[model samples]
Target: MRDALRRLSQGEAHPFDVSTGWDVVWEHARYPQKAVLGLAAGRLAERPLGPYDFKAGECRRILTRLGFAPVPKRSGGQESDDADDAAEADLRQRTGLGPTEKASLIRARRGQGIFRQNLERVEKRCRITGLRDRIHLRASHIKPWRSCSDHEKLDGNNGLLLSPHADHLLDRGFISFEDSGALLIADALDTRVLDQWRISQPRNASAFRAAQCKYLSYHREHIFLGRED
Candidate 1:
């Protein structure tokens, strides 16, 4: 499996008889290990090969290295319900706006049109993956929208253009950045999961302006998990 991955990284031909080389790796592994690797490889096979494919490939390598068992999946509906409840509670505490007003405000301030254009002025690419394509990037809030003041909702400094995956990590507080742009991973997150997701900690991001740094400070204080002085 290692040899195959090495060859793939070097731009060499597929090292196995079948295209699903990960299946071969899984077959050679022990009980629980097989299930984890098999799942990772299966995801890789689902996506078309491209520069974006690097993350999925790296996931397989990380899974192999860590040798951790797969985590149990949670129900989508239950998770969504919990998230909705949290968002509602946060909105009530921060904004004190009614549901209709909140919905309107969210629509107006949500990252699109002017907000997106403003983000482009500050960030040319994803800070993590360095992906420059506009289509593949999102203008994610540094301080979450539901928790922001009216002024902050539209502030360019309070936003970042991140790849969808990076945005997911940031929004969920699985990762954050320092004022100096160094990546910070939550202690609660499994190292293997971080590796599989290609989330590198202690990595510097693209340069941040002073205003962005202030907003980032808020994120570190309020959003980042396991934050320390």
Candidate 2:
């Protein structure tokens, strides 16, 4: 599989098709097969595959092993951050923030400050779960921070207060919300995993603002899986 991947990287014609190669890699490769396929596909195609093809976790692992860093997948139809190290260096210099400060800013940007305050005003509890405790709730961005524009980044309507489990599922694209606030579960997600997480299909949807509806449309088109339409 590695040899096939290497040959594929070099633009050489290979006898094995992508699916056949994937099967061999999935069966025998020590590394995650999706990562191997993602790397090969990304290299050859010069573009990152969607989460449905190579999940965020697998892509991160693949890039890390190849001496590259990972950044958030963009939501506005932009490409992945190919120059991750340069982008990080530029961020550090531009912001004059140390590692700890940068980490703090990231957390704040994702779920604190005016964003969280506004979300709290509109939503008193988790949208999917009934958990109301502030300690257990997170202000998750509908359009992720790294993907958001400056205005969208702090837009109150673009956020949701969700319990940790729901937040995880949403962030990783295992689930998403329609513009009308219906829950969307990825087809690729295992039922066993959902059962283990004690998550059920949410029947009651949250109320969405006009702006939130726009952001949710983007999520459905770019982030959510299962629907090809």
Candidate 3:
């Protein structure tokens, strides 16, 4: 790195001793290393030190100034996201899906884009409050995006257009639905809030399609919190 800097600044390559380079590499590997490289580099700067001089930081600062960000150590959540991305890519490869189709699937994961459009086909409004305005409603997954297969993620029958509060409740296992479309209120939910949300007591969403009912069954089993007597 130092030799490269010299060549770039002075237009003459520094003679590199391979034996010395190997010796330094071995010393770094075996000995307790100290962070003196930057100070040493700064002292040996080819030109006078300036405000933006990366000679003080062993070129890391200059690299950043040139838009070359140093790679950070990945945390557990970052690693998980990377693994999920790899799995999604593998799925796309196996299914022969192009970038556009893969992108659609990714958007569907958040119940936006294709997923919202699909839900609009089957459900026109929020099931709980009967809110018809699309802009105010959320297309939420019955089996949830994280728990579902790729096909299930975009399944129209696996979703509902819910108000924000309703979606939050459903997602957090505070509410669910029966195949008969009867609302299943979790014990943890404060019943008083239902009135504020303009939801009636002993309400039923009427009935679900067979496909929707299939997904509802999964939601009731897994997401519906606090069983009845």
| TM-score, per-candidate, Cα-based | 0.54, 0.57, 0.57
* Steric clashes per prediction: 0, 0, 0
Task: Give the C-alpha miss distance for residue 214 in model 1, angstroms.
Answer: 1.4
What are the per-residue Cα lDDT tens digits for candidate 2 across 1-229? 3553555445654322222011212222223234445556755877664336654445445554664433332231232223333444445576555776555444546488766776777677887877889888999888766566555656778788888888877766667876666777765567787788777775557667786888887665445543222
Segments in model 2 whose C-alpha atoms lie over 4 Å from true places: 1-89, 95-107
Identify the runs in model 3 with alpha carbons over 4 angstroms from their true place. Answer: 1-97
**Model 2 poorest 10 in a row by lDDT:** 17-26
In model 3, the worst 10-residue window by lDDT is 16-25
The lDDT for every candidate, in the order shown, is 0.59, 0.59, 0.61
Kindly list the per-residue Cα lDDT of model 3 for residues 7-100, writing each as its tens digit: 3334332222111000112212211011122223445765433323322223334433544322221132343345557766666676667778
Task: In candidate 2, list every pair of residues with a backbone clash.
Answer: none
Model 1, residue 111: displacement in angstroms?
A: 1.9
Cα lDDT for residue 164, model 1? 85
Instruction: Please give the lDDT score at residue 18 for candidate 3.
Output: 13
